[model samples]
Target: MKLPLQALDPDLFARAQALLDDEWLAHDADLAPVLPTVLARGVGQDWHKAGTFRHHLIGVARSLALWQQPRAVRLLGLLHSVYGNAFVDLVKFDMATERGRLQALVGQGEEELVYLFCTASRREFTQKVLAGQIEPDGSLPLHTNQGEPITLAPDVVAAFLVVSMADTIEQWFSWQDDIYSRFPDTDTSRQQKVHWMASLWPGPMRPSGRMLHQINRLGLALQHPKLKGRLPMPPVFEACTAPFSASDDAAAASLYWSVIQQDQPLADLDVATGVLEQAVRLNPWVGEPQMVLAQLYLSAGRREDAARAAESALQAFCSWGNAWDKRVQWDAWIAWTRILLQGATTDGPGAWPERLDKLNNVALRAGA
Candidate 1:
């Protein structure tokens, strides 16, 4: 089967395939090693948005990886806001003093991109893209901190937009909206919350507002008459812009978040299962609802249903981004899905030990 980014970035797509073939997250060790042990202390502790800074960072990097972005863009996503920006005020690295330290870690080129990403006005960049304001030479006009004007080269614009898209998708969630909203407690209704967040952004960027804005920008770029050969259209661009309705994501997120918040969520298995079933149908691209449904099915001894759900969950994680749950990496969720698959696939209690050995082998060779 032709994967999402197979044509645009064959090597990265192959890396993705290597990961799925081995059933482990280790295949992308090339990207993971850039964030060394020295920098981990700060990023691992700071709180950002709805989760820890480390989780958000890795999630953005993984999102870029899923989109089959080039290594530099992926690295930029990983360390995008370490120096802080307009949206978030948590700075893990000092701009003036720590630039050299970060450059030593991720190299000068990537560090520069990260600095640009952190210092530039992402809101302005987003607004320009939405307004179709790209210059004929593909230059993007932006302003850095304190409104210093800067125009990005065409090549730099492409890289910046990709990292920006990944960053927006990785962190923009209803939970994120609630975190930054004044009336978070007051807006209890699902539709109300979605509408409230949607109003904060531009156009029909509703249900999944931030991501939809990115999609809109990409769509305009793809169709732009002047950008025909100048702007490169990524392979995952098609998949990301696939036919997913606004209400689908809205309802799915509402249901998924509500259920997971309960005191003893799985205690009422029937209700939980039904809710997840609807959620999975509404937004099949997300894996958590399907993953949880598989768990519920397994507990109910519905082996066939459990196995099917687990497989679907794996497919979803492999195909697209999943920022529904920020606490865990996409690979960790894939491992959980495989474990559930093993439980649902095994014949009896004796088969458990044999499957366990296979799982270990897969994990060990995932990077190979």
Candidate 2:
């Protein structure tokens, strides 16, 4: 069982409370009626070996409030995990039988947001929104478990991003606590969360510049020395300036690669590789698919294939106008891969470490 908030270290509790207060939530009266019930149900529940589930929910809500999101959005953050969303499933509340009560407490609009969030299919959302599949007017059509398509308005998408950021930030903070020691699989989860945020940053539904700055600050905070090795770093590359126009083959390749990253069965590795080959064939000019293929090859210990894919990435990066500004990032990747290949091939003086240090210095200087 977790200690009560009051029992936490005074300074730590104070710092956490200060962070929460920064979100400027609505007056307590608005949340008063529902607070007790939420706390009661979440009391003994653990949130991924972090603090209590109630605490995580509160942190998310506070984060949304900090982002100055609308009341409905804040409430949605508070209730996001109650019905088992894509990333987490701490279902202390049943949505089906308790809709009216929840709606009555949070208002119809807020309740609807919670319902949509809880029922969204994570895979489809990633395929459509994160992969840049949008309607001409910039709306993303998300499918629920029932196979019904719901086109999200731009404002709703913005709210969703805010809530998602809050949830992810809270999780990252939890990873800093000793209770949630890093595990082998933790990096995959961290990567997916950061990738979602990075991909959405360049979308039409992006948050305000100020909000984006705040999100970046939170990301940087996770890089504190103590937490640096425990969590996956956010992508160093800037988001694509234009929306992706991936062919079906490319999209399928991305989907397969996503599955592989999530620790899917070994059988999926061959399928992912084949799909990536098809992607490269369908769109030889796109650097992203080729880069992903390189990573896949590297993971399989095929250094020669990895080197070939890295060369292709450089070629595609040079020819792809959308990647013009990302040359520094691509250069860093190429250099890193070369060092790996060199280390594998030579038993001479270990200059690779020095080269790697220089590479890191260059990356830091380049603000990557």
RMSD of each: 8.1, 18.2
Candidates in order, TM-scores: namely 0.66, 0.43
- For model 2, residues 1-368, the per-residue Cα lDDT tens digits are 21011111234223333443423333455555667777777544664423467656776765454344566776887788777765665776788798888888889888888888888764465445443454555455888867888877655555555465566544432122112222212244345354554433222221121222223333343333333333223221122111223244235434434543553456546767766666566444335556666666666766666656655564443322112112223234434434443433334442223342553432211211
> What total of clashing residue pairs does each candidate reach?
0, 2
What are the lDDT scores of the predictions, listed in order? 0.63, 0.49
Model 1 lDDT vs. the true structure? 0.63
lDDT of 2 at 140: 59
Candidate 1, backbone clash total: 0
Candidate 1 ranges beyond 4 A from true positions: 1-34, 37-41, 92-94, 97-108, 131-137, 181-238, 258-274, 296-305, 320-323, 327-332, 350-368
Q: List where candidate 2 sits over 4 angstroms from the true fold.
A: 1-27, 173-368
lDDT per residue (tens digit) for residues 253-300 in model 1: 777766676633555688888787887776666667888888778878
Model 1 residue 297 lDDT?
Answer: 86
